[model samples]
Structure formats: C-alpha cells, structure tokens
Target: MHPKKVQKLIYFVFCCLFTLPVLAQNRVVTGRVTDAKDNSPLIGVSVVAAGSATGTATDVSGNYRITVPASATSVVFTYIGYTRKQVTITGTTLNVTMDAAGTALNEVLVVGYGTVRKKDATGAVQKVNAADFVQGVTTNPLQQLQGKASGVTIATTSGDPNSSPTVRIRGTVSLSGNSDPLYVIDGVVGADIRSVSPNDIASFDVLKDASASAIYGSRAAGGVILVTTKTGKAGTPQITFDAYTAAESPLHLLDFADRTQYLQAYQQFYGKPMPAGTSTTSDQGANTNWFKLITHTGISHNESMGISGGNEKGHYRGSATITISKEMCAHLS
Candidate 1:
C-alpha cells in the first residue's frame, strides 16, 4: 500500500480506539443507616469503599452520600455495637440495616459442647440476642447485658471499660464461692466473652438449670453463658459490607442549684450567714449549663467488610471491621 494510505489507516485505528465504549463504570451511591431490629435511623455512621480507603460518614439523619470511581465495585458500612455489612452498588441508593451484635441469641443457643435451636432447648435457658447487648455505642460487651436478659443481673462496681461486671444468675446460690456463671465461647470453657468483638458475635445463649449445667460438671455450678461468632455459609465467593454513623447525647439532664439557691440552702442548713456585700445575684456565676457543657452529639462510625468464596473441596470466609467514635460530652446537669 502507498505511504499515504498506511498513514490514513493508522489514524482510523487510533480513532476507533478512542471511540470504543468507555466501559460503563461510573456510579454514585446514597443510603441511610438503621438498626436492623428496630429500623431506627443510625446517624453519623461511616461508609467506605472496600480496599480503597475512600469513605464518608452519615449525617444526623442517618443519610450518607458517596461518589465512587468507575473502578469501584463494593462499599462497606459499619457502626459501633452493630454487625458490619457489605453491599454492591447497582443503582443510585442502597439502604442498609445493621443487626445488633448479639440479636441472634434466641435463634441459636449452645447446649453442652454442641449447639441446638433455641426453641428445641430442653432446659431452662435464657437467650439474649446481639441486639440486646448493643444499643448505643459501648466499649465493654458486659455493659450491654445489663437489664437486657431475664434471670441474669449484671452490676458495674466501677465505671471502667475493661472492668468485668458482677454477673449473677437467678440470685446468689453461693455465699463464699464464685457466684458468676461459667462463660464459654465456641467450645472452650471458662472463656471471656469480652475477648471477642461484639460485632464478631452471632448469638449468645444462657444455660440456667442443673440439667443444663450438669454437662460441664463443676464448671457449670454457677450456670453457663455461651457465645458464638459468625461464620461463612456454602456459596460462591461473595462480598458484604455495612457501615453506619450515629450522633449520641445524654438522654436527660438533672436540675442544678443556682448560687443564690445554694447559698440560702447552705445558710439554713449550716447556720452560716452570707459574706458581707457578696451579693448572691452579683456572684451568681455564669449560668453554666453543666449538661450542655458535658454532653455532645459526637459522631460514632463503623464499617465491616467480608469476603467468602470457595469450591467443592472446601469453603472460606474472611471479614474485617473498623469502628470509630468521636469524643462525647461526659457531664450531666
């Protein structure tokens, strides 16, 4: 072919390459984060692109907006005290609901060294699901158990995150010996439930009877608390992501005594007169709203990503999670 004809062919090829479909790949995803059990909106939750580190947080109304590159395929969602979820984006918005860490309690419970359906349980066992243990943001899993389960009482002697609660089952059966029930995780006896992340748990079972406790022998004298973590199921390789953000504040505040009120009360109770010319009104001190000063609607966020895929030989599933909470106001009125 002539040189001019060859040059024309090269230009045509370049034009074709430039004109070919640009890989239909841009997307924008929007969604709201909510509690799976109650469907309550979770504000300030975090949402992110898996493996890319790109992310955004929910607003006060549980709404979130994110723009992903054409190469992006999946997004992860997470919040404190809730299971993380992963989702693939096909449309413009993806509404997500996150189950509380332990809400699956009644669905499954531990029996001896094995597991059984909660409904088929033969002994008197109280089951607490993940939701029962997670409500707002909590660092300690034991705190979530307080007042949530029947026949179980958890008391916090000190307001410390790492401290274990004084757990009692059906009142104190022993006076001097250990009163707390035996904690088991998976098949291991005497396990600390706190060691496992709240988001990692699938369910919790409480064995509370002599017949139920007999299997473990002496270890079950105080009853038993069983914990089960999440696992993979039979299927093709799949990815799931869940994220959420929430703004938390004190539920209520107490009334405070003003300077005048304090001085009058002090004078009446202690028989001490007010200092000369020290007008209570003059030194009323700034009307400090202690509650407002100590409380804040800080943002709490969480994200979880999981991948599962295998063949007939075997299966595998791996998951990772991240949770973050902004500093909160600690003072009440």
Candidate 2:
C-alpha cells in the first residue's frame, strides 16, 4: 500500500478505538421526606442507598440531597418511630411520605401465659421493639432499655459484660425472695435475657403491678420481663445482616508514682538505708509503664444474619448471631 493510504488506515483505527461509548456519570438527587398523615416534613430522616453505605439525612427543613452511583436503582428511607420505606428512583426529583410505625395498641402484647391489647391492660407495662436494639454493640439488651421506657431503671453496678444489671420498676416491692423480676422468654420461665441474642428478640414487654403480676402467682411480686423471638413473615425470602466493631479506651488516666519513686518513699518513710544497688533517680533503670503493662483498649464485635419468608401454608424464619468482647483493667500496683 502507499504510505498515505497506510497512514489513513492507522488514523481510522485510532479514531474507532477512542470513540467507544463511556458509561453515564451519576447525577445529583434531591427530595423531601414528609409524614403521610399530617403532610408535615420529616427532619433528620436517614436516606440510604439500598444494600450499600451511600446515604444522607434530611435537613431541618426535611430537604435532602445525595449523590449516588448511577447503578443504584433503589433507596431506603428510615426514621425512629416510623415505618421504613423503599423507593425506586427514575429521575432527580423525588418526594416521599412515611407512615407511622404501629405499636402494641395495634398489635398483640404478650401477658402472663397469654396475650392482650395495650389499651385494655390494667398493669404498668412497657414494650420495646427488636428493631430498636443496638446493631453492633456487646452490651446487653437491658442496657439499651435505659431511658427507652417510663418508670424503668436499669443500673449497671459494675462494667462486667457477664454481670446482670439491677432492674427496678416503680421501686422495689419485695424485701426478699428475689427482688428482681421474673424473666420469661418465648413462653419459658427462668430465662436469662443475657443468654438470648439481642438480634433474636422480636419484642420485650415489662409487666408491673398486681393486675398483671397476679397471673404469675408468687413470681409476680418482683415484676416480669417477657421476651419474644422473631417469627417468619409470608412473602419473598428477606435477609438482613448487621455487623459492628468497636474499641474503647480510657479517656483519662490518673497519675501515680513510678517504681523508683515508690521505693524511695518507702525507704525514707521507714527511716531505712537505700538498698545496695538501688538508685534514687526519678527515672527508673527500666521504664515500668504500669498502665501499658496492665491495661489495653477493650474490643467488641457483633454479627447477625436472619432469613424470613413463607409460602401459602405458613411462614418460616431463622436467625443466628455471635458477639465477643474483651475488656482489660489497669493494674494500680
């Protein structure tokens, strides 16, 4: 071929290679979240991309703007005390309305060996939803009960993970015979709330007062804690996973005497001569970092996975969860 023809052919090949189409870039998405009943804007609502970490929250005015990958097809909206909603986006501008979450008043509440409605209850009772449990912390479910209900006090005398907290409702009513409430899990008595995984709990109900406690007989004086495990729902199989990892360290440390200072003080106070090879220097021969040698940051992790679904007959649900935590203490000696 002629040189001009060859050059022309090469130029055509390069142009074709460069002309390949490029993927579309993600666009800015904006929207407003509001309550379905009142038409009032919802503020500080969490708007997240489904199955991903990309998300943002609604501003004080209930307005939200987020940049999502072009591949995102759906987004999830959630707020406390509100039902979660998922929306498919086709354009930049979206408007959403969320429904109020149903409570025990609309659902069933477990009582002594039976169930009842919240409005008809004649006892001092409190209920907590499973969805409200902390996702990734090693703390017990009772720890989350603090400030969640009225007239319920859960105090942790010590920070031991395996230790149970003291739970009191409307003050203690018994002088002995177990001042703590009776724990019932899934219709079984004497259940340890700590043993059951928090992820497995569907709901928790606290029964107080004689009207509610009388059903349990002798076990009622201390009150009652009822736990219900998650059950299956009818529909397509749905899977959910929650994972968390955390590290905790002392924010402040108290200053104390080092080995040399301690030994010197001992000798001076006792009016005894210094040991043969002992030095009075403030800096000990070998740096003894008491805190470093004795203590380290605590680490905790939790993982949970659940599957729910059903056919025409009935629903089936299953879940498993594991959590581990290690806490180290500083040796004052």
Candidate 3:
C-alpha cells in the first residue's frame, strides 16, 4: 500500500474507534420518579446513567426519559428533600421510588443571624418546645425552663413574683460585669423576657457556649437565649383559651415562747423577775400572735386567649394573657 493511503486509513480507524462508543449509547431508558411514602410524582428529579456524564431531569409529571449506553446497567435518581435512589436497568423501563430524607434530623434551628439544620449545627445548642414545658402555673416564663436543659441554672433570687429568675448558662463566667446571657426574642435583641408570656412562646433555642459570642458579641459572654414566638398558620380561624388557678400556703411556722414561758425563761436566765417596760413589750399586757396576724394564704390565677388564621397570601395571630397573684405576706416579709 502507498504511504499516503496508509496515513489516511489510520486516521479513519481512529475516528471510527471514537464514534463507535457514541453510536452504541443510543439505547433509550424511560422511567417515572415518585415518592415512596405517598406514591406521588416528584418533579425536578435528576436522572443520570451510571458511569456516564449523560443526565436529565424529570418534568412536572415526574416522568423522565434518558439515552444510555448498551453497557449501562443502572440509572441514578436524585431529588431535593428525598433520598437518592438507584434502579437497575433490567429493561428499557426503569421506575424509581425515592424515600423522604433526614426525618427529624433535618429540623431547622434559628441562630443569631440565620437558620441552620439541627444536624448541621456545630455549636452547643439545645432546643425546648412549649409542649415540653412544665405543666402547672408558672409565675414567670423562665420558671417553666427550670431543670429542662443541661448546663443551665434557673433559680429565683427571691420569693417575689415580679422578680425575674436568675438564669446562668454554662455556669457564671463574669465576676464584675453582668453574667446573664443575652436574650433575643423574635429576632429583637435585648428584649425583656417578662413581656412574653409562656403561653405565647413556641420554642426556645439556647446557644450554650463560646460559639454564641461569635454571633451576639461580648454581651453573650455568658451565652445566648433565642426565643421564637408562635405564629399563625395557613388554615381556618382557630381560637384557644387557657386558664388556671393555684393556692399557696406556708409549709411550716417557727415555734415561739408564750407570755408565761417567756417570763419563766427570763427569770431563770437572769435570776430575777422580769422588769416592767423592758425590751419585752409583752410586759405591757399585749399578747399578740404576730406570725398568725402577718401570714395568709396566697392565690394566683392566669388566663390566656389566642386566635390565629390565614390563607396562602398572608396570616395573622393575636394573643393576650392575664395573670393575678396575691401572695401571703408579700410586702410584710
């Protein structure tokens, strides 16, 4: 053969070798992607042939058709919020059923600036839902969180009902400055916790480490408390009412000496009869049970009402709460 003819023949063989694979990939594979739980068609699902760059997406009807090489044995299907699926190409028709992904692990959490999935959150975060709140009358919203979270301390500084509870996250950090964690309610920084009733709250997201300082700055040196309130949902009008009443009484009373016992004790100690008009005012003939006069039963009552409704365009929610508490010796003690 001539040398020029040989070069032409080699060039033709190389082109054929490259084109043969492309020509052999003409096998058509059709399939439908549907949710495994609901059997509903899933739209915008990605369909790709195994070990090949050829891919396509399912249409609105969740129907997909793709061309694959004859050697391709399996096809891959993927969709957002659904698990990835692989189907064997037994024949030309390849149907795929995808299961929902993430389950409870995909729950969304509200951070300082944005939201993150529960599994994706790297910081020390704890979430408390209203459903888990303590069942009973709560003088303050913070009281409901007592003993619910780890590495957190909630205590009342005094018995005063109006006093806010002392909240310490991961123990106290500051010696001079305020050690209380920063409170973020409904995206509002430094909002007073007293303004929000426990009945109106949906959840509490507590960032309990230095990671919180990165989001809220130095004030969050102690930690951060993110409060998410309840909002309206897309549904018919709904109204709710809640009310409760509680009574409190002193568990024990201190023992005190009567007039006769006091006189006898004073005589025994001083070796003399009690002097008249002494520090002992009982000498003036007044026998008063001060403890009995000062203390009484305390009563507390609370009521809450809320209404919510909306449509696809917008939603609205209104809520109100009333709390009345009268404690025994609240001012005298």
Predicted model with the maximum TM-score: 3
The parts of candidate 2 lying over 4 Å away from their true place are 1-110, 113-117, 131-136, 157-163, 258-289, 330-333
Displacement of the residue 196 alpha carbon in candidate 2, Å: 2.0
Per-residue lDDT for 153-203 in model 1, tens only? 888775344568788888897988887889888778888866865566766
The lDDT leader among the candidates is 3
Q: How does model 1 score by TM-score?
A: 0.51
Which runs in model 3 stand beyond 4 Å of their true positions? 1-46, 50-67, 71-74, 83-109, 117-120, 158-160, 275-286, 330-333
As for lDDT, the candidate ahead, 1 or 2, is 2
Return the TM-score for candidate 3, rounded to 2 decimals.
0.74
Clash-forming residue pairs, model 2: none
CA shift at 169, candidate 2, in angstroms?
2.7
Candidate 3 lDDT score at position 131 = 87
| Clashes found in each candidate (C-alpha, N, C closer than 3 A) | 31, 0, 0
* Best of the two (2, 3) by TM-score: 3
| lDDT value, residue 79 of candidate 3 | 78
TM-scores for all candidates: the values are 0.51, 0.55, 0.74
Order the numbered candidates by TM-score, best leading: 3, 2, 1
